[model samples]
Target: MEIPTELSSYIRVLKLASTPSWEEFSQVAKIAGAGILLVGMIGFLIFAIMSFIPGA
Candidate 1:
C-alpha cells in the first residue's frame, strides 16, 4: 500500500506543528521587543525636534 502525495504532505505539516520549542519563541519575542523600542525612540526624537521649531 502506498500513501497519496497530499496525505504525505499533510502528515509532514502536522509533525512540524506538534512541537513548540521555547528557544525559538524567546528569540522571536526578543526581536519583536527591540523593534518596538526602536520605533518608540524614533517617535520621541521627532516630537522633540518639532517642539523646538517655530509656529507654522
Candidate 2:
C-alpha cells in the first residue's frame, strides 16, 4: 500500500479507538494473567512427568 493510504488508515483507526476504562482494563489484565499462569502450570506438569519417566 502507498504511504499516504497507510497513514490515512492509521489515522482513521486512531479516531475510532478510545482508551479503555479502568474496569475493562482490569478485566482484560485478569484474564491474560490467568492464561499465563495456566500455561506455566501445564508446562511445569509436563516437565515433572518427563523427569519421572525412564527415558524421555
Candidate 3:
C-alpha cells in the first residue's frame, strides 16, 4: 500500500504539532515553572530540616 502526497504532508504536520514548541511553552511556562519551584522549595525545606538533626 502507498500513501498519497497530500496525506504525507498532513502526517508531517500532525507529527510537528505533537511536539512541544516555544509558543506553547510560553503560555504554560510560568505554571509549569512555578510547580517545579514549589517542589524544589519543599524538597530543600525537607533537607534543611533533616540537616538540623544532630546526626543526620
Candidate 4:
C-alpha cells in the first residue's frame, strides 16, 4: 500500500483505541505471568524426567 494510505490507517486506529484501565492491565499481566510460569514448570519437569532416564 501507499505511504499516505498506511499513515491514514494508523491514525484511524490510534483515534479509535484507548488506553486500558489499571485493573484491566493488571488482570492481563497476572494471566500472562501465570502462563509463563506454567510453561517454565512444564519444561523443568520434562528436563528432570529426562535426566533420570537411563540413556536420554
* Candidate 3 off by > 4 Å: 1-24
Q: Judge candidate 1 against the unseen true structure and give its global Cα lDDT, from 0 to 1.
A: 0.88
Score each candidate by Cα lDDT. Answer: 0.88, 0.98, 0.89, 0.98
> How do the predictions measure up, each by TM-score?
0.63, 0.93, 0.54, 0.94
Q: Candidate 2's residue-wise lDDT over 1-56, tens digit each? A: 69999999999999999999999999999999999999999999999999999889
lDDT for position 8 in model 2:
97
User: Can you write out model 1's per-residue Cα lDDT over 34-55, one digit (the tens) per residue?
Assistant: 9999999999999988998878
Give the candidates in order of TM-score, highest first.
4, 2, 1, 3
Error of 2 at 32 (Å): 0.2
Model 3 lDDT per residue over 1-56, tens place: 45698899988999887666888878799889999999999999999999999888
For candidate 3, the TM-score is: 0.54
Clashing residue pairs in candidate 4, if any? none
- Candidate 2: segments with Cα more than 4 A from true spot: none
The digit string of per-residue lDDT tens for model 4 on 1-56 reads 69999999999999999999999999999999999999999999999999999898
Tell me the deviation in Å of residue 52 in model 3: 0.4
Root-mean-square deviation of Cα positions for candidate 4 versus the true structure, in angstroms: 0.7
